[model samples]
Target: MKSLLFHRLALSKDKKGVLELSEQGQEIQKADDILKDPYVLEFLNIPESYQFLESELEEKLISNLQHFLLELGKGFTFEKRQYRISISGKHFFVDLVFYHRILKCFVLIDLKGGEVTHQDVGQMNLYLNYFKKEVNTEGDNEPIGIVLGAAKDHVLVEYATESISNQLFISKYQLYLPDKKQLENELNKLLDDEHDNSASR
Candidate 1:
């Protein structure tokens, strides 16, 4: 009876082994199929939307700007916003100032509600120049400036940066998240066209 029981257990294990392996293989195949789909790939790659100052009150926006900077990625640490600086006996406030550890200097950011203008970039450059001259340490690199706005004109931005010696960057801010399906569809169309061209070649 003991030998018969042992034999039965062995047979049961042998019978289910192939079935379990087959199920695992099927799961792997499904995962691979999902990964190979262009829509899925594009959805995974889309960046998260950034929050803008205009969307919230000034006090709240100042408080939350640190999180916003992290979402911007790269090396950034929130130093102060609406930071006060005095030049030639007049006082000025800088919006969204940060210190970049990697860049080893202060980063001054200006927020714009409407279209970015040359004046906006100029103000940022002025802040950078002042900070570099007054606040920067001897070992610190030159301060950099960034102007983020609702809408930016590329030509205007290019013109603004032409004569500036300081490191400057301009980026557009989005209040709402991107549409996943729309982004996916665009990526899929581009991928399909590329595949077709490669096949023809």
Candidate 2:
């Protein structure tokens, strides 16, 4: 939650690169205000070696809905799994759907078993467009689409999302907790750098 707040509050970049709370952040108006990157799904308790299909993963999440909801942050209420949407005569399914009371928008999530691809992002964009055009009510805001993959190439995702207008984001999910020692070392290094700066001053 702390990490989410840090990034959430800094939605827009000024000319000088200074960070401040965005208009949306102040009102919790956008999905980015509440979404977290690299969502830690340590509670899923799936073995690292286990190779599970996307459907299997969805089942696990449904089974652990309470913990999953907590990890998803506040104001998320589960609406459905495999929520079907029809486009023309064809059909598509979103892995998970939720409603954010604060944002007043539908949250669409697509789970990927491995690295996220451009196609995955494109598909999510389609879902968002569908929801915005077909699903949103008079008072509802635009829907948010999240592509949650096991791995993502930062540069790839960055480029893929360029020029898109809808509220779309791609995030990674990990089954295990992060390395504590690595975190401690990074924190220590930051503290040491601060001390050095103070001494020089």
Candidate 3:
């Protein structure tokens, strides 16, 4: 699925002359770059523009896990929806849990209905710590945590993630699907901008 998207964009190399994708997978990108900023949730039956709660989005994604997985990127297998982990004397549930085959790591996702916060990042960080120490096996890789919010604040993300050891990320979610043709056009524009920058340098 990821290959299809890359091929359609006719991408070869970026301004840095590095392949966007290789046999291993998306190269050495930080968690933020590794994850999509505005994840499209077109699989849900909601209208193109509609108000919804975090639970609503989560339920819709769970109802259509197959489509959700596809949008989630490649090599992802659904492990558990609303996965639970016991901490201290209390039980906490992760909104979604997926395992990435190629990456060989557990992917934990937390959904936010509105703006993301430092608290959300801290919660996900705690989840990562627990998964790494308790849930993961000898061969398991360190877990990756993602906090998906309806709105994004770059400043908040930078401040919240600073000094955090976990590979945590925060990104926005879009309720509607993007037009493929429109996306292609945007890709071309990006390529053109890259070319222009390279020429200037």
Top-TM-score candidate index: 2
lDDT of 3 by residue, 1-201 (tens): 533444323332342322444444555333443566567775687885677877888888889988888777766788987788897889989999998776778999999988999999999999999999988987778889999998879898999999998889888876754568966777788778879989999
Name the lDDT value of residue 148 in candidate 1: 69
Is candidate 1 or 2 superior in TM-score?
2
Ranking by TM-score: 2, 3, 1
Clashing pairs in 2: none
Write down the RMSD of all candidates, one decimal each: 18.0, 5.0, 4.3
Error of 2 at 194 (Å): 4.5
Residue 8 in model 1: shift from native, Å?
Answer: 59
In the range 1-201, model 2's lDDT, one tens digit per residue, is 433433322222331222343322333555776666668787889999999999999999999999999878778999999989999999999999999988888999999999999999999999999999898999999999999999999899999999899989988888875466755665566568669979999
Candidate 1 residue runs with Cα over 4 Å from true position: 1-58, 192-201
lDDT of 3 at 39: 74
Colliding residue pairs in candidate 3: none
